[model samples]
Target: MKTSDRRTARRGAMEQAESGQAAPAMLWRYYAVAIMLVACFIVLVWRVIDLQVINHEFLRSQGDMRTVRVEPIQATRGKILDRNGEPLAVSAPVVTLWANPQEAQENDEGWRKLADLLGMQSDEMVKRLRRHKGKEFIYVQRQLSPETGRLAMDLKLQGLYAKREFKRYYPAGEVAAHIVGITDIDEKGQEGVELAFDQYLRGVNGSKKVLKDRRGYVIKDLSLLQDAQSGADLQLSIDLRLQYMAYRELKAAVEAHNAKSGSLVILDVRTGEVLAMVNQPSFNPNNRDSMNPSGLRNRAVTDLFEPGSTVKPLSIAAALKTGSFTTETRINTSPGFLRLNGQTIRDARDYGTLDLVSIITKSSNVGTSKVALKIGGEAVFETFYQAGFGQSSGIEFPGEAVGVLPNFTKWQPIRLATLSYGYGLSVTALQLAQSYMAIAADGVRRPVSLIRGGQQGVSPQQVMSPGISRHIREMLETVVLKGGTGTRAHVAEYRVAGKTGTTHKVGEHGYADDAYNAVFAGLAPVEKPRLAMAIVMNEPQGSEYYGGEVSAPVFARVVANALRLLNVAPDRAIPMVAGASGSDSKRNGG
Candidate 1:
């Protein structure tokens, strides 16, 4: 064998062995790649299963957390209606302009257009936009009218947006200001009836989670997060017609007499429903630009003053109820003065001898003091308490005052004597009106109601005997028909009965010099009493600041108009009387 041939054979054999190794390596590499691909496919399939089934809810929740949103659904406030179903206060649609200040600041044209539509200076708007650039949400303006809001939207200003809202509006303005009350910027009740019935007036706020588009617009409806409940409506007992009439008369009288302040309240004698309550210098609840503590005060329930001679009827009634005297009982009131417990009691003028009717009609301070002495302080105090003094009327208002009526056991001799004719104590106009209501309703005392549903199960209480109340009613009628104090309060078309009070203003030390509070309380249609009223004029400036001069005229006008407005048939055929010149000519100052 040749060496070349042997080498060639070995080389060929080596090449063959190398070829065999390369084929196996290539096949192994292919198999490994195939296994890796198959493993990756298996992992992908497992991940799909985990995400679509086992962890489906978790992924869905993450997606929702990133893209879903919830927003509040505001409910409308309840409506407030008068007794006649007239809308006194209502909610009207409004819009609020908001902005992403950072975005707005960068768009000068947009900012300028927005400023123009908002009635704001361009430079000022730019400054404000710059100031709030870091804030995510900023309110540019609120409570824009529908027209203005539409204009703003038309501008399509960058980052500027509008949200729909409801604003409370008072249609009657100041005419029913104190009665209807007012709401706050967030549509929440702030004062008056609004505050009193806030729970019923304020609706429940609901919410919803919705899917939105890229432009932040809500897409299809989603799940309801919460349900909204609308507020309940309120129907008050106030008669709008009577209220207007009373307000007009009270305003006129206040202007005529130059009174510092005045208040008038009318009540339904049978049901104790307050038909009209008015105070002068009232502010419009809608505007509220000129509102202050003084104008917002409800004097009918908040203010207190000495009742003076107006309290005489209560004393006389007490004496009569005790079987101490009758309408014809006589007492010696000559010299117009009497002394009891070392305190002297004096009348406006001397009346030597007068019967019970004459004594009450004349408003004799001396005669009333003598009668009170006979009735005793305990009885007088009890009578005043039973008439609803020294307590709230339970009306739904925030700052009602319980007027002072000192205990009889704590009264000194002078205090007792002064209290005989309405002094040394104080009472609100509402309290005085309630007293008259007691007489008009034949001795029953009903709780005053502001709401229309009759206040649960409460009923009137019999405070006095019917016989005594009738007798007192007759005596009070004589006061208006032929009396000394209530002559001007008599309405021509109605049989009226009332008492007058002209009390000196008390200072820190004692009574002020010459300053007086004139008050009058009365009822109309004495034959079948329907309404009772009380009026008070604080610090009336003029020579005729007596109750008969300053307050009675207002009372007569209010009663007359209220009766006509309420459609109460006139009980008497006499022409409507005015001033102090009537059948009764009592000059007692209340």
Candidate 2:
């Protein structure tokens, strides 16, 4: 029975397979599939047109509004500290007022109130508002006083807001102005150590995306792009106490002598650190009214002048190093006046067959010239160069002048003679301090430093033999004694050693008839020197322009205070030193 049913079923299947009635239904199925595909393509095209053309700009703006508010996170600038962590330059908070012009213009009453509080003319304020009609932000005023800032905020203008920003301030004021320098309104360094270490002193600003409401107040922070980092705190080698002392003394001397300008530098002989550097005509960093662009210069490292007799010890070093003379060697300086090369090199008085030791004590120009001739021109220039003359002191100071030493090939007889007495080549006050440091440190010149601990393990370069340096220092010690040129530079409790210099100022054409630079360079506690300093008084008036008179007294006062502050022990007893302490010849390069 099942076989017979299977045969009928097969016959039915074959019949259905061959049936023509199924054709239209299959065609209808194909048409339905095709229609569905066409409909999908149309929907895709419509969507493309909607996004790429119809709603492009609107969607873009909406996206930007949601994610693109830049909220800046203020960064604090670094503080500059002295060796003992005393604040030299610090950043303090100040208020800056700003406004959205469009919002403020919409609030006429608020704008009027703002104008009144800001002390601005209504017409001018209206004109400014018109100029920047729809601007998002503009500074209404910057660096407002705390009281003014509070009063302006009290007005509560629609778009006006007061924000805090750090402004640089110098607490040490004029006392450390030359070294600490000044910063601009944006807290960018403008001069001195501030300018030198700007990258370290300036901070990195940060910003983030923030959501703001209709009133322009922040709603939520979307994401932080960068985190603000405060600048690195700097520790300098300058001792604040010494800086104050030097500044006080230098200022007093400048005022007392009625000098045009003055510069003083103190160095630690043991480590080659600049302990103090000050200049006269200094401006207080705290008061902008006291600021003069000309007074802003750091003269200790910038101004160049012929070293005058300050370089006498260097000449002596040259003579000894060249095997031309010993400390006991004698030179005939009889009659004083030397005529050569249409120029005359003369001593104040004929020193008369003086030995090297006696020559230094007397500051005999003829004697120094004789030895310089004996050593030859090349030797003299080489000696000065080795002593850090005509070179940057490596103090990292901005605009530091490298003193001038003419090529030895161009030296004439007169040039060599003049150079012997420190009239031809030029040097800065800092250079003089460095050279004297060489003498104090046994002729080994180390790189001068402004950073604390920067001089540790610093290998020194030998510029002269220890023997000759010792002898030179010993002889210099005599210069501050009873019959020397720098007796006024002597301290009461220390064995002082130094040299005095007076050079006619070089004017636009030639040497000025009256203008002069009186300079003193010395090392204190000669037995074991601790500090080396240089002082320069420019164009001292009122009948006293000698280095010993104008600059040495400053040196004495500053050094005495500095030694005491450092707790240095006395190396010598107070002696009855007697001298006039005046320049020997008005016209001579003493």
Candidate 3:
């Protein structure tokens, strides 16, 4: 009993000491943990304040530099329409493939596939990327169709993306190339009406801010910086139907005659609006690969040549305007040739004596020279000036020529005679057409226009007396009848009136003996003239360099179709003038 009591007392004493030491250790542990938690909380609060308040803008800018981007929004170009609302040029949707060169550098296989799809060499594409290594953006391929672009984008090449764009499309192709013109890859107008009205036809580009992911995928549109404005549609005065007809005929004629080049223009006599303007050796706006300096030229308004016999009618008009001659006036073309100042002006044959009407019908250079000598130089000059010679056509076309009309004040006797018979001066096809247009419009010279509603508020100029104009018109009608030089230009069921011109081209020394410019300018429906037309063939090969043979037939074919298409009423019965003999001769001012 004594030993057990001692052991129990010692154990109780040890337990009481251990319990006191445990309580102090537990208290210290709780205090240390509380202080550590407070320190952590303070550090976290300071960090939040620094980011949200102190360095907020800096942090936000750094983040935005990686994710936000400004991008361009392409605007669509305006359509070029014909007067009848047919589209000559329109914007077609396309896609351009671009790349971030830095990211694309690592994807060789993808790039190879992309290059193959684009019809490009893989090595060349790789070299291009290497050249633009540090650049963020580069064009991989531009102007692909939507389907093709989708196929290209589906490849999922690294750093590659597609951009929407508009490409200019020509519905009529080369038929309207010289008139409607063409646009560059960027949709900027390059030639013709496109160049003439670039500002009105080009649209304003817009911009927007966007958010992108690390992979360069656009996540969301942040904001629009600007709105795009589409360009205004341009309505041209051309009738596409007439343009096609003219182009087909002119091209065929040029090929048939083996001509170096050619041009044709048709105008509305009443409104002065150009109905059709065509050039051969034409380039297709849709086929840029075939374009050349020659094909790109708008020859009708830009090229100049001697007027030849075409201006003889104007010379007679000048004489009549001076009251020195009348429709009944007679001129002796004895021996069919005249020698003045050592220069011999000869006609096709010796039509010994002829009236004013017969002079034009035969296209007699001798008769015209006699008339011009009587009228003096001033009268002829004034008439030519009034008929729009030596002046711009007022159409505002790019590269339009103001032809050479020598000042009559400086003329010698020989010069005056030459000018009278359509020499010693030059004129563009458009100018020639406009001059004839004045005659066709009852002597009212209206400003020529390429745009549908252009040349507004311009008054019609009375270039010749009404009676004289009518008489001239009547005489021109005779030129398309039997025994006339331009009988090939005669249209069926239509009273055709016009002139034939065969001018010698200027050579290194003087007028070339072999080279020539064949031309025909005229109007139709003699009772109420509606259309004025001009056809010019440059350097026709073989035996067909005469205007009557080379150009007049093209005029007849095109006008025949044009008149019918326009629903112009037939004025008279068909004339049997198609078989009329020899064309106006090159040696006879034909």
| C-alpha lDDT of all candidate models, in order | 0.82, 0.86, 0.89
Q: Estimate each model's TM-score.
A: 0.89, 0.86, 0.90
For 345-401, candidate 2 gives per-residue lDDT tens digits of: 888787689999978888888898888888889898998998999888989799999
Segments of candidate 1 deviating more than 4 angstroms: 1-54, 102-105, 339-343, 574-588
- Full-model lDDT, candidate 1: 0.82
Better of 2 and 3 by TM-score: 3
Quote the lDDT for 15 in model 1.
100
Positional deviation of residue 72's Cα in model 3 after best superposition, in angstroms: 1.8
Q: What's model 1's TM-score? A: 0.89
lDDT of 1 at 434: 85
Clashes of 3: 1
Runs in model 2 lying further than 4 Å from the true structure: 1-68, 119-123, 145-151, 219-223, 455-458, 577-588
Superior candidate under TM-score, 1 versus 2 = 1
Cα deviation of 508, candidate 1, in Å: 4.4
Per-residue CA lDDT of model 1 for 1-590, tens digit only, reads: 89999999999999999998899899999999999999999999999999999889989998877668887878889999988899988989898888877556464587787777778898888888788889868888999898888888777766777777888998878888887889998988887899989989999989889886543545766889998787888999898888888898989888988998899889898788888888987988877677877898788888889889888888888887788688888989889877767766777678788988878777778788877877789989988888888877767577778888998998766677789788887888888898899999999888887777545577677767888888878777766654456677777788788877888898887888778898888888787889989999998897778887788888878888888887889885544334445322224454
